[model samples]
Target: MKLLIIAPEQIPVPPRAGGSVENVIHQITSRLPEGHRVTIVSLRRGYLPRKSVSGPVTNLRVPGGSKKRYLANALRRVKGLAFDLIQIDNRPGFAAAVRNAFPHTPIAVFMHSMTFASPPMTTRRKANADFRHADLIVGNSLSLQRSLMSRFPAHRSKIAYVHLGVDTAQFRPSGKRRRGGYRFLFAGRMIPRKGVPTLLRAFKIARKSVPSIRLSVAGGTGKAAYRAFLRRTARRLNVPVRFKGNLPRKRMPAFYRSGDCFVCPSQEHEAFGLVNVEAMASGLPVIASRNGGIPEIVKDGRNGFLVTRYGKPAAFAARMAELARSPELHRRLSEQARSDAERYFGWQLTAAKLMELYAERLKTASAGRRTK
Candidate 1:
């Protein structure tokens, strides 16, 4: 099967920068079986070639001054190209444009979150129309799938889910740090909804019980004022936190290994926490909010603890303090985290399942044609 994957216009495919959607695209395309050819259509960024080929995959980059321009450029280049299936990443408009170009081909709109499917991004009428046109709708988590199904009950049968994954081999466990303090790591944008302030407040409280406990924050961009506010909040609370500004994808494995535990204190409904999977792959226990699809990944007292009251600092502090004080619990959770990542959350599994889905869709399409 020859597949064309249209990545979100915001980021490049071989995400030299950092983007979860782009990373997912690159990982899945790279791992697909050699017998099945793949073509990636992505926005040009940095020094990536306009067109290139590697193994069974082809890279096609387009000028992306704007989302509109990106779509125009993408559609123009692939207008006459034949593909078994087209996968549009996180954009309803792209899926619509692709459908206009190739009406008969099977199209799948992959939803990484509810950000694009709801009000403010696209309305119920427009989103419903887009879903109706597509052959399949994919969400990265069951929570996201259910949410979409609820919104567009007419398209419930088309909405399916597959969990995102981490590269376990690359993000292996590191030797335990002998530093006196137990460190917790946070990797993501330091935005309000991300709950960086909440984590800082929680760290401050956790430190009172375990004085040596520490926090290291990695990843931040586009919100300089918010970043400054986070620093001020940490200082005013008398908390000592290390802030590592937006590190590239290659450095993330080491960043994950540096911490004794990973904390994702998101105050919002996270569709799925990919960073938590990366941390678990690195053998660190995860302590995340019990909202959204997080409960699907981190089981309480099994692989890690979940903060039931995520918005409150005390809730997160309790979990952080629990792990900091108990070495046996930490060790057990760490082992289980690594085991779960290897056994369940790997890019290979995600890629295989995606390929199977595409193959099945193509087979069904071929049968329909034969009957016609």
Candidate 2:
């Protein structure tokens, strides 16, 4: 089968600069079965060429500017090619444009979240039309799928989920024992909704008992005000929280390795926590909020601890302190964390699931043609 995959315009493919969606697209396209040929379309960035070929896979980097211009450039570049299926990453609007170009081709809109399917991003009528127009709606999590299904019940049959993954081989553990207590690591955008302040509060509470415990945050992708707010909160709490800024994808494995335990303190519902999977793969147990699809990834007292009191700093502090205090418990959880990622969250498994869905779509389409 020949496939055309569209990465979001935000980042180029082979996403060295850093974009999870771009990373997911790169992983999927690179891991397609030998029989399949794939072409990945992404925004032209850095020194990368407009087009480059590597065996069965082709990469097309289109120009960036406005979202409208990006889509136009991408669609224009692929006008001559015919594909068995076209998958658009995270943008429902792109499906319509591609549909206009290849009206008969089966189009899959791979939504990472309900961002595009809801208002403020796009109008409700537009969202509904976009959902109806796509041949398949692929979500990254069951929670996201459920939300989409409820929002567009009429089109529920087309919506499905295939969990995103990490390259366990690359994200493998350092195999080093924790020698200097637990260092809680947070690696996401520095935003209000991410609950960084709650983490700060929690860290302070934990540090009160475990004097040698540490917290290192590895994200700077937010407004200056928000970053300042986090600094002020940390100063007021009088805890020395290390802000490592945003590291590129290549450096992330090392970033994960640097910490003893990983913390994801999201106040809002996450569609899926890829960072948690990354941390788990790196053999660091996760301590994330028990909301959204997090519960699906993190099993309480299994891979890591889940804070049921998601907003309350005291609850998060209790779990952090418990893990810091108990080396035996952390050891058990760490081993299981890596094992779970290898078994369930590997990119190979993720690619295979997506391929299965695509193959099924082609099989049904072929059968329909035969009947016609």
Candidate 3:
């Protein structure tokens, strides 16, 4: 198949930034069949208005002035190239644009997550428009699909769940185990939604009960005030928190290896907790809030623990304490977590599933054209 992928911006096959969406696009494009031709149409630069990506990509840089230029680019491709499918991984704005560009061409929109819960009016409108126009809609988790259904009931049949896969080879656990108590790790951006502050509070509570326990907080937005607040909170609470700001993706294995457990304290609707899966892949048992699709991956108390209520630092702390005291339980959960990730979240299996969906959609499109 000649696949044309229109991303929000130019990202390398294995993305270093842009969060999980970048990771998903990288995985699919990198693992696509060799015979297939893959072309990426994206913004020249994320912030600047450029013409093309420098790397090895078939770049059609938006001319200038408006996102409408993106529509013009898609129209040019539809008329100029013989593409089998177009996969869009961004907002509905792109989807509506593509539909206008190639009305007959089969377009599939990949929904990495939903924004309805906290969506702006424009976003919601575009999401609904994409639902009406796209031939197929792929959701990263059941939670995303359910949220879509509640908002756009008419497009219920169009939504399909495709769980995101993790790279076990890269994210697999390190064998080195440090002596003394468990070292807890928090990776991800230091944003409010991520609940970094909540994690700090929980860590403070946990430190009171377990003094030997160590904490590492990774990632940052360079929010100076926010960073200062966190540091001051740690000092006031007397918590031994190491604010090791932003580690590179390649070095993540080392960070994961250094920790005994991984915690994601996100308080909002997380479409899919990719971090949870990555932690499980690394053989570190996960402890995350039961919000969003986290429960879908973790079998609470089996592979990891799940905190239900939001803002419950005491409950979060207590769970950490339980895992810390129970060595046998920790061992069992860690082994099981790795096994589960290997069995279900491997890239090969994920690629195969994606191919199956692509093939099915292609066949349907072909049949519909013949019938008409």
RMSD of each: 1.2, 1.2, 3.3
lDDT agreement of model 2 with the native: 0.88
lDDT of each: 0.89, 0.88, 0.76
How well does candidate 2 score on lDDT at residue 361? 86
TM-score winner, 1 or 3: 1
Query: Which 10 residues in a row give candidate 2 its minimum summed lDDT?
Result: 175-184
Using lDDT as the measure, the top candidate is 1
Put down candidate 3 lDDT per residue, 1-372, tens digits, no spaces. Answer: 777777654443344654557677767666665566667665444554334443333445443345576556545754667677888885666776677666777888887767532366256655676667788887788888788778777888777777887888888878866786789999887778898788888887887888788888888775888878888988888888888887767777777888999998988888888888888999999989898888889889889999997578887899898888889999999999999999988777776777678889899889888999
Estimate, for each residue in 1-372, the C-alpha lDDT of model 2 and write its tens digit: 889998888888987755878888888777777788998989998789888998888999999898889999988888888999999989897777788898899999999877777778898788888766688899999999898898888888899999989898899999776567579999988878789999999999898899899989988664888888888888888998888877887888999998999999999989998999999999999999998888889999999999888899999999999999998998999999999999998887888889899999889888989999
Model 3 alpha-carbon drift over 4 Å, by segment: 10-13, 33-35, 45-79, 116-118, 121-123
Judged by lDDT against the true structure, how good is candidate 1? 0.89
Candidate 1 scores a C-alpha RMSD against the true structure in Å of 1.2
Off by over 4 Å in 1: none
